[model samples]
Target chain A: MSTVVDQPVARAARRRPGALSLGLSRGALELKQFARTRPYLIFTLLFPVLIVLIFGAAFHGDAGGGVSWTQYFVTGMIASGLLATGFQNLAIQIPIERSRGVLKRLVGTPMPRSAYFIGKIVMVLVVSAISTAILLAMAVAFYGLALPDTATKWFTFAWVSLLGVTACTLLGIAYSSLARTGRAAPSMTTPVALVLQFISGVFFVYTGLPGWMQQIAAFFPLKWIAQGLRSVFLPEEFAAREVAHSWELGRVALVLAAWCVAGLILCLLTFRWTDKD
Target chain B: MKTLIRIFRRERAIVDAVTENLAISVRGLRKAYGRTVAVDGLDLAIPRGEVFALLGPNGAGKTTTVEILEGFRRADGGEVRVLGTDPRNATPAWRSRVGIVLQSTGEFEELTVAEVVHHFARYYAGADDPDKVIDRVGLTEKRDARAEKLSGGQKRRLDVALGIIGRPELLFLDEPTTGFDPEARREFWGLIRDLAAAGTTILLTTHYLDEAEALADRVGVIARGRMVALATPAELGDRRNAMATVSWQGPNGPESERTNAPTAVVAALAERFGGEVPGLTVTRPTLEDVYLAMIDKNAISKEEAA
Candidate 1:
């Protein structure tokens, strides 16, 4: 009776997919799934827009100076968006997916285990870019901030934003791996984010803060991201470049990359796919 | 008997030649949780296109063993060939070939059944049609509905649908009918039977003896990490040749004898009656009886050990 059917089915059952493909597929799938959720959509797009508006009011009557509030606000807004998307979003999604058995489900599938993390990276990048565009629009139209003309300023913006995104993304991933539940991630991430915002000179320039506080900020990844953003949006002469002699671009990039490396290692070590544990 | 044994061994030779004949094979599998041994040196060979049931109680290591096969957890030691590959290093191609139905289900609250299925299908080179899979699981009306809104049974059906939509070769049905209503259970059974008939090799683990007795070709009873018995449902408790209770109209009432041969006792009773015996009955140990006796014996030993 069995002779009438397939022998290849069992053979097919035995195969598993490559890690890269699995990771890419999982990333795409996660992004698609994440986009459909109303809360996630609001957090990704709306949260940053709200931040821009709040700061827009605070910087209301003064956005035309050499380091105009609008220009300064745009750089900060982009950095914050990257932080929100890369750190907060990751911390929220990982623990929830782990709790929900989404992570576990992927583990059972032939999709590469790393694909899930890779997918998250892709998702954060996409959301961050979109958020950056929205802030840029606000800076240009509502706040009357001029677009940078010098190729160097644009280069600084790109590198600085990349640095922010990279550091925040890795830190988020590392922190999420520590979180046991999705509910706890927001609480855990909010404090680190808020603390980093204060320390990164996001609210006020780091030069004005106490020396020790600024030094402590220099040690953290967020400080470099915020510093990079300042290098892009702020004029070269307003100060706060004392952390490293000449913007410390190389050291910042290296430190951010190191965090990414460390994050990958931690994720591999502790990140669980299933809610079974 | 020796010749029959030789023939069965002969089937083993062809097994290697016809690589696709054996859907899954396990040898010397062991798993331990901390100091407690869960699945110890287990062995199993399930042929392609057969529904094999691994029946055990809670904490019998059924779930652990299944997780190892699903490649969700790393085994301490074992040789497992699922389809034809070791699950621990399973490739995406290998993954697409296997389907798993987990016991606890959590879902994306926003995704419709159709959307979830469609999304999973992209992982496999060859995937079943999402609509067809949904219809097969009897969730056509609920296809557009959000997964969060599905009833318990319907949610399970969606889980089943996702498992099969990959068009997997070997499907791991881990107590698939748990928490299902009787009607829903029956319907799920029908779906399972259909999947088996369509050439899917199913490795089912269930606590329900009735379900196993009804659906399985062969049942392997696992107790404390050991396969204590492996045979057809009727032969599980030696039910085929086991003693039966014979009762008939007696001096006071219907007395009974537990004997291997029920016919002889019934014949003697017929002679005493000098006609058709009133209130005559012959009954063997039911699957449930055998199961209870089997577990009862273990509980007694556990108490002794304590």
Candidate 2:
């Protein structure tokens, strides 16, 4: 009986979840349902708008040295909003679904397991794209910040941002495994995001920090993500503060890739199909 | 039923084509949650195409055993098979062949009933029609309603609807009618009976004994992870040969006697009461009586062992 059962499963799994076979129609369905949700709608569209509005208060001409904080604030907002939507939202949403036995139900079906993640990844991308566009609009309208004349900078920015999103999203899935309940996940997301924000120069410049802090913050994908964005929008002819300071696009790409690889591995390692916690 | 089922040509291997076969064949199953032995060397064999009920008190490892069989949890030390597949290493194909209606409802607050069912329908290769499954579970009118908007009983029926939407060979119903009213329970019972008649194997675990008697072809009582008894309703305990308590009113109030030969006892009592034995009763042991006695005996033996 065991051999009879093992043979089919072995044959099926021998070529498990190929690129084409991975995505199911259910993934499209899940994305649609997730997009229509009130919380999802608010987090994806409204929450970022709210965060930008609140931070916009700090960017007024009268505030500080009037260094056009909007230019700097734009990148920070992009970093903050993407992380919040992808990582923070997922951590809480996943636990709630698990608690509701939704995950359990899905595990019992023949639905390709990758379909579950592909749906979330698609939602993250859509939400990130919308948020990025709105942030860019806000930056252009009020801050009057300009971009490179050529399309190369935009292409580089897009690739870097996508890599960062993958890292953040996969890490969110990994962090969600620690949450015991749905309500607890939101609270847990805050501290992790806030701590990363503090160390990764979301609140201040990473250059002013100690060497140890810089070394540590370098490991955080958000730090490179924000830095990578800064390199894109910031003037190429701008005076360099440090002697050896240069934005190596390859390093930025490599770091983001490494983070994504690490995050995906962690997520796969710790994720539970049921509410084992 | 045959004519109605034939209409669903797309539904392949929908019913359990079993002939008095075993749905679940567990051998020496064991599980533990860190020093606490949840299921200690337990075993069960439920027949296919039959409603087999598992009854046990709290902490008797009923849920753990069922979860292990459902492939939700792994057993540490034993081989366990459900619908001919080892549940420890459950696959999508194996999963597609089984259905589970748990007490806790799976809710997607945003999606309407039709949406949720239609979405889940893609998971199985040859699934039942979403509309028909919803209608069968008696939620046809509320097909557009969100799952959370449904009443408690309706929610349970929705759970059942989702569970059976895949057209599973074996269905595990854990306390399916816990919160149902009498009428709702009867309606749920009717749905269960309909599924049973369709040749779908059902393994129901319910605290309600009457529900078991009404649904199960056979019932097994598990105590501390051990199946203490397994038999049909009429054959359980000494139900067939157990002494009938013959009681009758004599000149001195009432007299009672326990006897296997109840006819002879009734004949003798007739002489005392003249033509008819006044207030005569020849009562046999009921299901409840046997159940209580069995459990009580187990408790006493346990205490003695301790």
DockQ, candidate no. 2: 0.25
Can you tell me which runs of candidate 1 are displaced by over 4 Å? A1-6, A10-28, A51-74, A141-144, A181-184, A239-248, A268-271, A275-277, B1-21, B241-285
**Candidate 2's error at A236, in angstroms?**
2.5
What is the per-residue lDDT of model 2 for residues B123-179, given as tens digits with 9 covering 90 to 100? 666678789998999999999987768888888888898889887878999999978
Off by over 4 Å in 2: A1-24, A62-67, A208-212, A238-244, B1-20, B243-285
Superposed Cα deviation of residue B204, candidate 1 (Å): 0.5
Give candidate 1's iRMS in Å, 1 decimal. Answer: 4.7
State the lDDT of candidate 2 residue by residue for A1-277, as single tens digits.
1111111111222323432344545446566676767776776677656766676776566212223556766776688777876798788888988877878877777777788888788777777888888888877886777765669888878887888888889988888898987778888888888888877866666666687887888888888888778777766643153213766677878998988888889988999877782
Residue lDDT tens for model 1, A1-277? 2443565543334234555766666667666677878787887788777877777777645332256665665666677888888888888777877777777776676565566667788888888988888888877788766677799878877877776687778778778877777777778878888888887767766666898888887777777776676666566664344445456777778877887788767766776666553
Q: Which residue pairs clash in candidate 2?
A: none
Please, what is the TM-score per model?
Answer: 0.83, 0.85
Alpha-carbon local distance difference test for all models: 0.77, 0.77
